[model samples]
Each structure stands twice: as C-alpha cells, then as structure tokens.
Target chain A: MFDISFENAKLFKDCVDAIVNLINEGEFEISSEGITLRAMDPSQIAMVDFKMPKKACSSYKVEGDVKIGVNFEDLSRVMGRARPEESLNLKLKDSRLEMTFKGKFTRRFNLPLLDIGGTVPKEPKIEFDANIKLNASVLKDSLKDASLVSSHVVLSIDKNSFVIEATGDRGDVLIETKKEETVVIAHECTNNAKAMFPLEYLNDILKGADSSTVITLYLKTDAPLKVEYPVGQAEIVYYLAPRIENV
Target chain B: MFDISFENAKLFKDCVDAIVNLINEGEFEISSEGITLRAMDPSQIAMVDFKMPKKACSSYKVEGDVKIGVNFEDLSRVMGRARPEESLNLKLKDSRLEMTFKGKFTRRFNLPLLDIGGTVPKEPKIEFDANIKLNASVLKDSLKDASLVSSHVVLSIDKNSFVIEATGDRGDVLIETKKEETVVIAHECTNNAKAMFPLEYLNDILKGADSSTVITLYLKTDAPLKVEYPVGQAEIVYYLAPRIENV
Candidate 1:
C-alpha cells in the first residue's frame, strides 16, 4: 500500500505533461525514495526519464516498492483540471489509483490500473562532443521559426556559436546564438558537432518547460540529443534520435 | 479618395472581430461620419449593425461616400496580426484596400475588393417590454453554463430578477440574478418578458465584449432580442430572432 500527497498539483501535473506527448502508457515505480518513470515513444524515436524525490512531497508512505501502470492521456486530462493552488493526494485502493484535490472544495477521481507488460528500456550511452545551457524560450522560438520552412532542424555547435537551420521549398530559417549572448547561460565545445532531428518531437519535448527555465543540451555528430530540465523539484530528461542524412 | 488612420489598431481589430462571426462578407459604407456596416447572417436569423465615429480616428479624409465590399474572414485574419500598440493606416488604392501597420517595423497588406451584391437589411422595430443592463461576463458565463445541458436557453426577466434556464438529456442549468445583485446594473419590467435563443449565436455575439463591459439587453415575449455593447469608441448592435416555442 502507498499513499502520497503534494502541497500543490503543479509538480505532478507537469511531470505527466512531460511524458504524455511521447509515451501513451507507462509504468510508475513508487518506493520510499519517491516516484520514477522511464518510457519510450511507440515509434522508439524518443524516450523520457522522470524522477520526483520523497523530499518534494508533503507526505509519503509506502510498505514496499510497487509498480503501477497507467494511461498517460487519461491521467493528463484529470490533472489538467487541478487549479494552481490546489493540493493533490494519491492512494492505491482496490487495484485502482484514487486522486483527490483539496482546495475550496474536495474533488476525487478514480482511474483503473492497466496490466501493461514490458521491461524498462535501457538508457543509451553516448560520449557527447559539446554541451550548452540556454533559456528554454530561445529553443522554443527557434523550433517554431524552423517549422515554417521545414519538418526538421539541424542543431550545430562550435567554439563560437550555436545555430539552428532549416531549409524547405517555401524558404529557409537560420538562428545563430553567439556565446556572448545572455540567453546562452553556458557553452563548452571540444569539437564541432551537428545533427538533424524531427521538429515535431523536439517541440513536444519542450512543452513542459517554462520559457525562463534553463535547459541543458548534449550533442554529437550523427548521435542522439540529450535534454535535461527541472520541473519544480523534479527532474525530467529526454533523449531523441537524430535523423541521419539519406537514411 | 478616402484615407483614415487610427492611433492604434485595437479599435479597428475589435470592430472586425465583432462582425466576422455573424456576417461572412459585408459592404462597409465610408464617409465623413467614419465607417458603418449593416448585414444579416446567411440563415437570416441574426443581423449586425456596427459604427465607428470619425472622432475615434487620428486622421480622417473623404471626398464622397463610398461602399467597399470585403470578406470578413480575410480581414479578420490580417487584422489579427496587428500588435496592440501598432498604428493602423487604411486607404483605398486602385479599387483595393491598402492596410499598413506601423510600429518598429512597417507591414502592409493589399486586399482585393469583392462585389458582394446585397442591399442592406432594415432594422426591425420592436417595443421591448423589459430592458436590463448587466456585466457582460455574467451573461457570457450563463450562456456557457446553459450550453452544457442544451443547445438553447430561455431568458426571462420579471419584476425582481433575470433568469437563464436550459434543460436537456444531460441535465439542467438555472442561473438567476436578482435586481439587487451588483451584476445587474439596471433592470425595468413593465411586463414579464421571456424568449428562447440559440446558444451558439448568443455565444458568438458576446465574443468581442470584455468581461467588464456593460451590455444592454431588450426583450419581449416571443420577440427578437436586441443587444448593444461598445468596442472602444465604436458601437456594436445585434438583433437575434427568437426560436418560437411551438409551430
């Protein structure tokens, strides 16, 4: 048996939002440490890793480690109803997950658990050649600009600057950010690296991030891209495979 | 030749938004008085009367009265791009409307005139039995609440209160505001008035009104409803034919 409560629903709502776009259903592991989820998209092009430590919760109780499978879409819809200041409570009862929000009034929702059978996928190991930390809005706006011209964008990094470029029948969009710009919080590059990725996946990956939030990115030549950002006290990480040229 | 400019684009944009929902295309009359439009919806169930006074424009010039036909959908789309602080300039050039937004940058669009041939509809004369002025949001929210249960709502006004009621397979919704309530700024009833109106049209009619704006309503038993609201310095009026209770 496990029961948990959060001071506010924002953290949990954001966590579900970060995963729902990529994974339809996922297994959430609850233990004394807290709640954690790792799942890959149906197309296997993207994966998300989420962690919320026990310290972040207002109250946490558990008899032993247990795994609960849930449909992210349904969970997202329920969570979306929570007001910003409302507290959220979760409990396992009769093999169903019961959620309650406490504010001016109490609201409860019961969601049935699914018997989803699948082993957790292993995280990819890659030695990135460059890393950069920048304001999330810069990346979000660049992706939107690229979408007007092409379905994919090429992210490149060198010693002097980071650039996003997209070319299509309509036109081409190129956004270059120099290391001196305040939007680029940090930059390090031992070797120049570039890779092209689908714009739709990248857009969904950043949906949960606030414009002011700082996001760290890892890139390499013809390798997957790694993105890490904070959702309140929780941490969310995403890995998206690059679209190799002519492949 | 006719030329006009507004200190900001908000007023003109709002005027277009108020008319676009009910009338797809309309002929605008431009003269020394400014601009005016009178058109009926395709179903002939609703009519819109809009007027923008010359005093509201920063500059106004006219040689004589001219009627220009336009597609409201296209006009609305272009006006939607204007920022609140951008100044708007409009002129008749080569039988087309030339619209330019000036701010830090200058953006212009040339919309070809259409020959939308239709005589302006005459406004109906009705001696309303009851009249009330209330906060726009109160009416807007009541319509939305009623829509959850039925496609149409009954608006009733008696000596002491104004009520909106809707009943359907799902459930029923009833919202009553007493004359003493702050939401009801003014209320008068020589005779009880009640009429049924379609929710979709009512919803669209109130789309352009700000929550704080005060809207005046005139109603009578089994008669059409009349509503008037202000879009900045401009005035917008709408008349909606009621759905007769029984054939």
Candidate 2:
C-alpha cells in the first residue's frame, strides 16, 4: 500500500502531460528515494525519463519499491479534474488508482490499472559536444514558429549562438539566440553540432515547460537530442531520435 | 468605406462567441449609433440578437447605414488571433473583410464576405409573466450541472424560487435559488411558469456571462425562453425555442 499527497497537483499533472502524447502505458517505480518512470515510445522514435523527489510531496509513504502500471491517457484525464489551488491525494487500493482533489467538494476519480507487461526501457548512453541552458519559452516559441512552417526542425548550436530553423514548401522560420541574449543562461560547446528531429515530439515535451522555467539541451551531430527541464521538485528529460536521411 | 476600432477586441470576441454555436453566418449593421446583428440558426430552433452601442467602441464610423455579411466562424477565428491587450481595427475593403490586431506585431486576416442571400429574420414578440434578474453565474452553473445529467433542462419559476432540473437514465440534477438568496436581484412572478429548452444552446449563450454580470430571464408556460445579458456597452439576447411534449 502506498499513499502520497501533494501541495498542488500541477507538477504531477504536467508530468503526465509530458508522456501522454507519445506513450500509452508505462510503469511508475515508487521507492524510498522518490518516483521514477522511464519509457520509450512504441515507434522507437523517442524516450522519456521522469523523476520526482519524495521531498516534493507534502506527505509521502511507501512500504517497499513498488512498480505500478498506468495508462497515461486515463491518468491525464483524471489529473485534469484537479483545481488550481486544490491539494491532491493519491491512494492505491485493490488494484485501482484512486485520486481525490481536496476542494470545496471532495471530488474523486477511480481509474483501472493497466498491465504494462514489460519493463522500462534502458536509457541510451551517448556523448554530446554541445550543452546549453536557456529559458524554456525561447525553445517553446521557436518550436511553435517552426511548426507553422514544417513538421521537423533542425536544432543547431555553434560557438556564437543557438539556432532553430524550419523550411517548408510555402515558408520558413528561423530563430537564433546568441550567448549575449538574456534568454540564454549558459552555453558550452566543444564543436559545432546540428541535428534534425520531429517537431511533434519536441512540441509535446514542451507542454509541461513554462516560460520562466529553465531548460537544458544536450546535442551532438546526427545523434539523439536530449531536452531537460524541472517542474517543481521533479526533473523531466526527453530524448528525441534525430531524423536521419534515407530513413 | 467603413472603419471602426476597439481599444480591446474582447467585446467583439465575446459577441462572436455568443452566436457562433447557433448561427454560422449573419449581417452586421453598422450605424452612427453602433453595431447590431440579428440572425436565426439554420435549424430554426434558436435566434440570436446582438447589439453594441457606440460607447463600446474606441472609435466608430459609418458613411451611411451599411450592412456587411460575415461568416461568424471565420470572424471568431480571426478575433482569437488577437492578443489579450491588442487593439482591434476592422475595415471593409471592396468585398473583403480585413481585420487587424495591433500588438507587438500587427497581425491581419483577410476573409471574403459571404452572400447571405436573405434578410434577417423578424424578431418574435411574446408576453411573459415572469421577468427575473439574477447573478449570471447561478444560471450558468445550473446549466453546467444539468448538462452532466441530460441534454435538456426544465426551467421553472414560482412565488418562492427559480429552479433548474434535469433527469436522465443515470441520475438527475436540481439547482434552486430562492428569493432569500442574494443571487436573485429583482424577481417578479405573477404566476408559475415552466419551459424545457435544449441545454447545449443555453450553455453556449452563457459562455460570455461572468459571475458578476446580471442575466435577465423572460419566461412563460411552454414557450420559448429568452435570455439577456450585457457585455461592455453591448446587450445580447438569445431566444431558444422550447421543446413541446406533443409537438
């Protein structure tokens, strides 16, 4: 039996939002340290790594390291029912997931558990030549602008600036941020790097990142791109496979 | 030549929202006094009457009384592109409707005017025994609650209270506001009145009404229900035909 309470449910809601777009089912590993979920999309095009520290919860308790399988689409719908200022209480009982939002009225949702029938995907190990930290909004807005022009965007970083560009049949969008720009918090590059990835995956991952949040990017030439951001006390990392030519 | 401007486009946006669910196309009558639109849904089950006085617009102009037909769906989409604090400018160029939202960047939309081949429907005249003014939220909340149970709601008023009720196969919802409740502003009922109207129409009409806004209801036994509310310097009225049991 496991029970946990959050001061505000927004963090968990955002965590579920980050995964519901690409994954249908996954398992949450609850341990004394915190909760961790790592999964790859069915298409093998992307992977998600999520972690929430136990200290983030107002109250957290666990008997042992337990893995709970959940259908993220249903989990997101249940989380959407929470109020802005309401506290969220989650309880696992009799193979059912029960969520209660403490508001003027005690609203509750009982959801069925899913059998993932598999283990979490192993995190791929790769070396990167460029690591940059910037404001989440800059990336989000750049992705949105690129989406208006094409389905995929090229993420490029040089010694001077970080760039996002998209070209389509009708138009193209280009966004560049130099290190001097306040939007770029930190930058380190050993060599210039560029990689093309599906904009849809990046767009979905940005859903949980707010404007003021800080986002870090790890990239290498033609290698997978990793985007990381923190929500409350939790950290979310997404790895999007680059769109190689001739695929 | 016609040109008009608004400090904030929210009034026009809300106006379009009030009718877009029911009426697809309609004519806007621009006069020295302000702007007015009246149309009936294609199904002939509901009619929308909208009015915005000159005082509502930052600048109002009309060479003469001019009528321009517009597709509300397109207009609503255009208005949605406006930023929260952007000013709105509308001009009639040839047969095209040009709308510009002035913000950090001027965003413009050019849409073709539809040939709304007919004149506006004549307004219906009916007598009612009850004219009650109450907090718009009471009505809005009641409709939302009823929608969770059924597609239609029964609105009733008598000497003591205003009641909204809905019954379906699973469960039922009942919301009642008595004279003692501060929500009831000014109520006059000479006799009992009851009418059944589709909840979808009522729900859409209440979208623009905030909690502080006043909503006036006109009712009679088994007759169409009339709902009226104010947005800025404008007044909007909707007439929804009642579903008679034997009709």
Candidate 3:
C-alpha cells in the first residue's frame, strides 16, 4: 500500500506542471526516502530530473520501492482543478490512482495507471566553467525579447555581465544583465562561456518556474545548459542541449 | 484641430475594447459635447451605440464638429500598449490620428484614418414589459453557464425572479437570481416576458462591463433587447434582435 498527502496541493501540481511541457508520460519512482522522476523528451534534446523529498508531504507511507507510469497530460488536467486553499491526498488502488481534494467540498478522481516500458536515461556528467543565479523573470523576459527577432538566442557570460542576444531579418534584440544588478543574485566565472540554444525549449523549461523563483544556471562553452530551481520543498533540474551553428 | 487627454488610459482603452469585438471599423462624431459612435455589426443583427461625454476627459478641445473614421483593430492595438499609470493624449494630424502615452516614458503611434463609407443605422423603437437592474457579473456568469449546454438561451423575467435557462443534447443549465438576492438591485414587471437570444452576441455585449458595474436590461415578448451600462463617465447601449423560435 502507498499513500501520500499534502497540506497544499500547489506543490504537487506545480511539480507536474514543470515537466508536462517536455513530456507527455513519465515514470515516478516512489521509495521510503522520497519520489524522483528522470525522463528525456521525445525529441531527445532535453532531459528533466525531478525530486520531491518525503519531508515535503504532510504524510507519506510506502510498503516497498515501486515505479508507476502516468500520463502527464491527464495528470495535469486533474491538477488544474486544485484550488490554492485545498489539501490533496493520493492513494494507489489496484490498477488506479485515487486523488481526493479536501476543503469546503470533497472531490475525487480516479486515473488508470499505465504499464510503461523503457529504461531511464542516465544524467550526463559535465564540468561547468561558470554559474549564475538570477531571478526567473529576468530569464523569462529575455527569452521573450529574443524570440521577437530569432528562433534561437545566444547566452553568454563574462566577468562583467550575462547577455542574451538574437538577430534576424527584422531586427536584433539584446538583453544584458550586469553583475551589479540586483536581479543577478550571484555570479561567478572561471572562463567566459557562450552557447546558442533553441528559444522554444528554453521557454518550455522555464514555464514551471515562478517569476520570483531564484534559478541557478550552469554554463559551459558548446555544452548542455544545466538549470536548477526549487518548487516548495521539491527540487527540479533540467539539461538542454545546445544548438551548433554551421558557418 | 482636435485634442483630448485622459488622466488614466484605462477608461479609453476599455471603451475601445467594448466595441472592438462587435465592429471592425466605425466613424466617430466629435463635437463640443463629446464623442459618439453608432455602428452595426457585419451581420446587421446587433447595433452598438457608444457615447463618451466631455466630462469623462481630463481636457477636451475642438475647433468644430468633425467626423473621423478609424479602424477599431488598429486603435485597439495602440490602446493595448497603454499602461495603467500612463496618461493618454490624442490629436488629429492631417489624415492621421496621433496617440501619445505619457508616463515614465513617452511613446507615440500614428494611425491613418480610413474612409468608412457606411451610413449609421437608426436605433429601433420597441415597447418592453420588464426592466431589471442587476450586477454585471450575474449576467456574465449566467451567459457562460448557458453556453456550456446550448448556443441559445432563454431569458425570462417575472415578479419573483430573473431566469436564464439553456438545454442541449449534453444537458441543461439554469441560473436563477431571485428578487431578494443582492445580485438583483431592482426588478419591475407588468407582464411576464421571455425571449430567446444567441449566446455569442450576448457574451460580446457584456464583455465591456466590469463585474462591479450595474446593468439595466429591457425585455419584451419578441422584440429587440436593450442593455445599458457605464464605463467611467461614458454610457454604452446595445440593441440585439431576439431569435424567433418556430413551433
């Protein structure tokens, strides 16, 4: 038997929302310590690593370590109905997952579990040259600004500032946040790093992050970008492959 | 030369938004008293009469009475850029309308006037049996509820209550606000009145009214419906022809 409950449903809902854009289905591993999910997008261009510690839940119980496959789309639809003031409970029953929301009125929904078949991809090991922590809104706004001119943006970091620039037929957009700005919480660099990434994937990766969230980004020249942020007590990390420009 | 300024751009923006959905282009008759526009939708089933008294403007100046044609789409686009704290200024420059927003920074846009050639249609005269004044949110919520089940809804009024009901293959939805309810501020009915109306048009008509605004509705057995509401110091009225049902 497995059961879990949350004092506020927003945490669980937000966790699912973070990855729903990159993947439609995922396998969640539940253990005595916590829950974790590692999945790669269908295009194999990005991978998501999600972790929810047992302490995040008000109550958690497990008989044994188990993995359950769920359709993210359907889960998102159910989570969308949760109100901020409501508590949520989840129980595994035979072949279905029973979800209950408690507040002024009790609402229940039963979703069928799927038998997913696939091996989880291993996280890549990389040595980063620079790490920057900044407000999520800064990144979100810069991505939107870049999208106006091009489909991809070049993210570069130096000792002085972090810059996002894009150029196209219409015009060019450049957003530079200097190290002295309050929006840049922390900045460090051993060597200057620059890489080009698809704006669409970056937008989807940032969708789950709130504007106030402080996000840490690890960067290296011509390598996948690592982003880490916290949702409630949970931690979510994403690695996006860089686009190579052919001269 | 004509010049007008608003302390808050929201009033002018909302006024344009109210009619942008119904008509694409309209002719504004500007005079010392105020500005007025009367136009019919492409289908000619609904007519909108919009009036903004000179008192609503912070400053109003005009050399003489003038009629200028404007594309609602372009005006809406420009108005949308106005921030809440910004003040809006309008001036007639030759064949173009110059809009300037003054706030933390100044931004200007020039929209060319169109030669709109259609004559304004006269408002229809009708005798109604009932007049009800209720909160705008009540009507907006009722229309949304009816849209779930059917494309058309029956609005009826009697001495006791105001009812909106719709039925379709999926199911039926009925929302009733009684005379004692705080939502209904005033109710008067000499004879029972009922009429069927297309939900799409009703939704468009209510889109401009804020939830806190009180709206007055005049209804008849099988006649055009008249709705009146206020936006800032401006008053907007709409007349919609009821759909006659065949037995």
The digit string of per-residue lDDT tens for model 3 on B126-229 reads 88899899889989988988999999999999999999999999999989889889888999999999999999999899998989999999999888899999
Clashes of each: 0, 0, 0
Task: Score each candidate by Cα lDDT.
Answer: 0.90, 0.83, 0.88
lDDT of 1 by residue, B1-247 (tens): 8889999998899999999989998999998898999999889999999999999999999889989999888788767767769898989988878787775434556677889876899989999999999889989988989999999999999999999999999999999999999888999999999999999999889988989989999999999999999999999999999999766
Give the alpha carbon lDDT tens digit for every residue of A30-79 in model 2.
99999999998888899999999999999999888888899898899888
Give the TM-score (0 to 1) of chain B in model 3.
0.97
Question: How close to the true structure is residue A163 of candidate 2, measured as C-alpha lDDT?
Answer: 79
Give residue B115's lDDT in candidate 3 (0 to 100).
Answer: 90
Encode model 3's per-residue lDDT on A42-130: one tens digit a residue.
Answer: 89999999999999999999889888899999999999999979999989987798999999999999999989878999999999999
| TM-score for each of the candidates | 0.55, 0.57, 0.55
DockQ of predictions, in order shown = 0.04, 0.03, 0.04
Docking quality level of the chain pair in candidate 3: incorrect
Show pairs that collide, candidate 2.
Answer: none
Indicate the residue-level lDDT of A35 in model 2.
91
**Candidate 1, which CAPRI tier?**
incorrect
For all the candidates, what are their Cα RMSDs to the real structure?
9.1, 9.6, 8.9
Greater-TM-score candidate between 2 and 3: 2
How much DockQ does model 1 earn? 0.04
